[model samples]
Target chain A: MKKHLTIALDAMGGDQAPAVVVHGAHLARERYPDVHFVFFGRSDDVQPLLDAAPLLKKVSRFVHTDDVVQAEDKPGKALRRSRQSSMALAIESVKAGECDVAVSAGNTGALMALAKFILRTLPSIDRPALASLLPTYKGECVMLDLGANVECDASNLVEFSVMGAAFARTVLGLQRPRVGLLNIGVEELKGNEEVKEAAEILRTSDLPMEFCGFIEGNMIGAGETDVVVTDGFTGNVALKAVEGTAQLIGRLVGDAFRSSWRARLGYLLARRGMNGLRDHLDPNHHNGAVMLGLNGLVVKSHGGATVEGYATAIGVAIDMAHHNLIHLITKDLGGVAMDRQESEPLTLETDKQAESKSA
Target chain B: MKKHLTIALDAMGGDQAPAVVVHGAHLARERYPDVHFVFFGRSDDVQPLLDAAPLLKKVSRFVHTDDVVQAEDKPGKALRRSRQSSMALAIESVKAGECDVAVSAGNTGALMALAKFILRTLPSIDRPALASLLPTYKGECVMLDLGANVECDASNLVEFSVMGAAFARTVLGLQRPRVGLLNIGVEELKGNEEVKEAAEILRTSDLPMEFCGFIEGNMIGAGETDVVVTDGFTGNVALKAVEGTAQLIGRLVGDAFRSSWRARLGYLLARRGMNGLRDHLDPNHHNGAVMLGLNGLVVKSHGGATVEGYATAIGVAIDMAHHNLIHLITKDLGGVAMDRQESEPLTLETDKQAESKSA
Candidate 1:
């Protein structure tokens, strides 16, 4: 048998789970002939779809788990209680070295909790962060801690900055990714104390990276920064805003296309151009959010993701596995074992130093 | 000699200060003939521009202050040191009741600090927030805490919610605005403990408003909610993301419109339609960030704002002054003077409760 990239996919997560998840796995199986998928969930729920797909029947395996972690359940509580959930099983596959990567479209909070609880953070890593690839007008930018650790301090932000840069290098094909500290203003002293403190440490820290000072929100999609580091709270909010704005634009185009026959004809005339634009704006095309700094590779898909979205997510998992991104992040960011103090803890005095100089 | 809407303009503020600020003031005077502006800066700087426009000389007054605050100056220090800065003088005009509104595109932090120190928050309001009317595909949404009070707790968010809703109702013509908590997920448990806790308070608080529970980033421009409340950090990030994405889309469209002869021909054919869309997406038209929960009306404009943007900001200030938003916030939400005990500080237990009930 040829060596295959085995991926354990949690099939019972996400808003359209089992159906879209199973379909996505099948679609991915066709695209990547060498990928072997282990679908974890209730066998009864997944069997009908697997039986329907000849390709899935050929290359996929089933790891039965009875519990389904509802999106509504508290993340910590759900992770602890739903021990047999598909998400937990999928992560376990990576922990047990049964699969090269784990993919899920389940409750993101639960996935974060379970993955952190089971696989744990890499040594020296303070916390695991979710890094999402944003398709900007210039090209693509990596936005990290999309919705992971919300209440992060200066040190957590610094760690995130290093980890985000590493991910950008490994996945986004940037050699020395220009890391930007996302703030309201582009000036050096523009953000809250946490951001200000982080900026100071990032400036002087002898990390093998490029620190591109501060970047504001408007520059996020301008392709000014390759890796934008922010706490999960702000990052998640910004990601949603971009997503919301894109969808809003889509709706506006739709409305304009339907207003009048001239408009409709105009819409038909512009359909090709609009489609080209849609090709870039579509969320499904940019499907995966990688949980970085984790010991095991875990990729989360949008909970409302369709089959195509899942396929895109699976592709992300394959890329991460192929490049061994987690291993690289571990090696590059001090093996994730360094204590908080060792990982360049920024002090108020250093921040004051930058402030004084800038002033 | 007709009574005019008097605005104190900070001529020495912003990147293109003295030039763009002077030009913006001239345009506002030309556009709004009954509008009178008091230019705050050196008389020498104003006289040269005033010489060019005889109409500006007729409609404007000058406050000669030599000091100017640089964008990089620390807010607290700048607020103290730049006592005679143009922006400070403009703010003082409003405090002295010499002008209906104070408008500046200068150092935002400094402006905010000065406004708070001089004018203060409304009775019972803990912190003042910057709120703006954001252009959406549907129409517009009111977003609060755009760049004020970055480090906030749940009580601050609740106040933002109240203030944002009132602004939306007063400015955007929304009745009983549906207040949405901007968070990582629609599920209540999906954000930080602060968000979760805020969700619970918003649910039970007697704000005489329509509470739409939780909303994520992408929902803002989708008209999912009329008023979206978040902390300064997240709000600023989200607002900037929208601004950046819009610029990106504009650039892409501009490129496509100029790509080739055939595409250029297509662009010509769709010029009218494209123009309408472009006008709809223009950020300048969405001018002004209202500093909500303040004791007086304070508006912040883009430091790089053109004449039209400043004019629109002045118009918004007129509307704010006309409606007495400050008084409404104080009367309805018990602005900054409330006892700390009654402020209802957020706790982990409330976060857990909100998560279990709604998530």
Candidate 2:
């Protein structure tokens, strides 16, 4: 481990940027005493906020930048204007070895684009997938390719299985995570060509994980496996739908408790236990989504996540960096056949193609 | 309307057949006094059960069929052996105009194949989509192609929108339903080629419903639209994922209430409200899935549905028949651009083609 582990922050990103970014850093500092931050944003806006936290200001370095990537900016537009932007500079720090990892709560598409364009993916990596932790019946399970690639081939899915297992190991602290590829049915005859092909490869692969075969959508939140893998489109829809279902349940539960006087009184008495239920359903409980397959760790927090949520994102970056999640993935991926396409040298042609595809 | 509304029952289908079928028929009889049942099964097995319900016996007719379609029968094998199977005979009754609709709690794939083969799709309809009502915040919303087609083209999605709108209008009683095509993002630029093309057509098509553009998976249960449409692959995954989420919430709620004595006491006091919440989230609340775009009505009840739930499936069939859902779909489809492909000549070639696709 380095004497000082640095986490680069896009201070001006997020819905409540500068403020949440500073406060979240302060909270993360309490958790990791040896951690340092390099804040990349307009100095005038960030300097005053850092002043409020003497401890954080003591270990943090400030770099001024005038460019800001708007939340509505598309990936292609954001990449062209990336040179002076806080998000780009923060990621640049990682590529330049100035920081161990980069953390941002910026436009997800832009963050993904800039990270891929600047740092590039690891060797043999075609695309970096978005990985996040979702609540399940047993506890929490990791799901990957959560909108990174709209469509994925069999090789992409196989790569996802390896990456997802590494994530579960480092983030969730499991030695050999049980991995599953999401499909409509568990039978061999079910699902599309890609899913069936992926299953066949995973069944034979000798990766450092237990391949539990196919998992259906309903079985996702049931905690049937440690890691659920799928194409970006299906994964993204299922994740958001799960979130929506949780919210719907919360709303209905509230309505039920307030339906009558006895129910209202009963709610007051059971407020503690009810609060427990709320905590379980809350998305903020485990807040960070890592862009796996990248050469350097890059974590994306929810744009509208709270102070604690942003801090939790920083925690993920720290854990991955400390535990060497990148090294683990590199070793696991060595055995698998991953296509080579994009490169580190910044070329407009390649980046533009990736930006459009990632868009 | 016919003086007597006849509903065909695959008296040997479902987890609890004959008994549940007869009892469910009795339940529907109470709701609609003009309804009659044509039960197709082994008379030896079903007649004794029917005799227990004298009122149901008074208005029902029995057709002996020793052969039965096992729950695990594949559609292709079942189609070849369907001549004497109870499910096939029940659907044949609909095609022969002996019954207004067919209701079964049997294997969904076999039911869909046999129905499509026997009755065929309406003119200009490429395939019949499986449509069902899902609970939402506002009330109930209809979602279509819930695993009927593994893949769909642009025109198929448009036809689903038309069929889904008709369903919402008849089943949910919405005068002019608001429709939304399921996509990862609400943006026009987002989603696959087929989804975008469907949106363009629906945007300008003078369909008898409101087109609300793209709807993400999260907004499905939020009741943002009365009808949501998607390809079968995505639709089936989302539906089951939603089911998993609901079950997770139910289990968590139970655990929370049992956490403490106060919570348990509170739950007792709020029992009525809790029960209401349970009923709202229960799949049985909206029991039937209709094979829309077909010339005849076919309702699929959950395999494990109770007597009440089976009756609810019958209720959906009765509503569609009373409202002339088929006639409405035929008229609405006349204006839309739909491709015609499959036919009802009972040829081995055509039925085999659809059987493989539907499988």
Candidate 3:
């Protein structure tokens, strides 16, 4: 039998820590018995709950760490000072080859810092990017650098496209994923100088992904592109805006349903469909945020994630490990580099002509 | 009755031209008998709509212009070549003192270019900003540079804050409108170089608005800020993301209601509250995109706006004119230059303490 992927998790992180993280671990263990978890943090904080579970004992290990990086800490100073932080140690375990993957719901900046410092970045990658899969009408769209690198140059976006496409293929199971640069408009010269320069590089890059040109925020959720790339600042804003609006509208709908007995009946009747949609659109279900272009697998959960969110994150880590995503990314990008060196100037003109007319 | 603010309308512009514009003019005129519109286009194109409606004849005046700017045309070339374009003539009407304001539901770039060329920017304003009122938990929030200047520096954002504040105070009736720089975090030193520099400048800018420090996208709809200023690229992405999420959630709820009989009953029972919410969240109710920092008043309607959306935009323009928004912006910013010469070093220690505590 194939061995389950071993993942080191920071159990002391997030708003709903210990309880939610413990619940998540139980759910994941039940679903994937082959998976093993090493819960890192203060054992005193978790012993009572850990002592209560029998099945959890068979699937889990624990690493005691006493420190944590606070959310409000200065990124540079906190990352430097928190040598014994559970988040940092969890990632280090992956780097030390003790685990296949690491998961954290701690401070995002600290996670990114620790991942970058310990796991290191892949070749041809200036800075590793964070990518998330968002549900859309057609299917899920992958948007990268969702708040990793603040200022990205042309080369940075090209790297994001390649990494994002590699992710879509390995995790999302897409073939030749179409990549797009996020801009204010779809027009070629519609954005700032950064975008204009990036478009030129992406158009000519020998990356395995199909560079689908520029896309707008409205188009991102509409599933116009399989992989969308943008600098971290803009991506973060866009991601948060979508999240905020969804929560607002969800609240509005919930309030409407509870307004009267008739509406409650309507909600009851629609419970099945609502459940299907709830399963589909729930961020908790798609909790894992992959730190792409990194040497090892790392997932960051939301700071306020509940138990279900952590379990979903573990599931994502297991999936990535099963598919050997890191090896696949290396192979894909390596092949692209090899092809670029051997081949003559390819028929980009044909591609451009085809791009001018599309579905 | 107070006469409606006379706004010159570029009738030949937009996707559903002549029809939407004419229908909007009639609707506004009927609803608010004081409102008046001056339509500029090939008189023949607009005359047909007016020929059918006696009420439109009462609300609108026609000006003949032979040229029109297509959405596809390059903005710079379009503005330079289409000297006799209806959109240009409409703005010129405002500059020529023939109208109180100019309204267009045209190619955004072309409209911006024409407004800048014809109306010119107000003194002390580097670039005019497109400030749109977004519905939030706390009534409405002013989001500026929603796609005006793509590239902006520190000084540009300070100017945006001044102009946006004036609009919020005069148009939205916000008192001491709290202006926040849109950044990734609330920290004193966070975000990109542009945002950091802008935050510093805002600290000392002698604008009439209250500088409330940094605000992130999630905090926007939470009523933490009254006016949020960012570079155009970020603002545009945020706005589109919010709009897209609302649409997606709307689709999900509609699907739920149609999925089962009980859900249908629930929807019917909740119809009143749901309707209220749908109306509250509708983008049309917040249709005005005021071009702040311009010497003359200019408002833009969405290119694909319905007649109702156009009417709301007209109402917004009327309100701005009535509040003397243009004169207020000029006075506030103009006074800054004069105040610097007149006053001694304004010790803002108490203000800084308040800001630090708030941060």
TM-score of each: 0.85, 0.93, 0.90
Which lDDT tens digits does candidate 1 get at residues A148-205? 8766777778888888888787677778889999987877756776788788878877
Order of quality (lDDT) = 2, 3, 1
Query: Model 3, B265-315: lDDT tens per residue?
Result: 767767887897898798888888988888799889988889999988888
Per-model TM-score of chain B: 0.86, 0.93, 0.88
Q: Which DockQ values do the candidates obtain, in the order shown?
A: 0.35, 0.56, 0.32
Mind giving the per-residue lDDT tens digits that candidate 1 earns over B190-254? 67656776778777767757999888898888878889899888888888899888877777766
- Better by TM-score, candidate 3 or 2: 2
Shift of residue A336 alpha carbon in model 1, Å: 8.6
Chain A (alone) TM-scores for all candidate structures: 0.90, 0.93, 0.87
Q: lDDT for each of the candidates?
A: 0.80, 0.88, 0.81
Pairs in steric clash, model 2: none
Worst 10 residues of 3 chain B by lDDT: B338-347
Best by DockQ: 2
Between prediction 1 and prediction 3, the one with superior lDDT is 3
Instruction: Specify the poorest-scoring 10-residue window by lDDT in model 2 chain A.
Output: A338-347
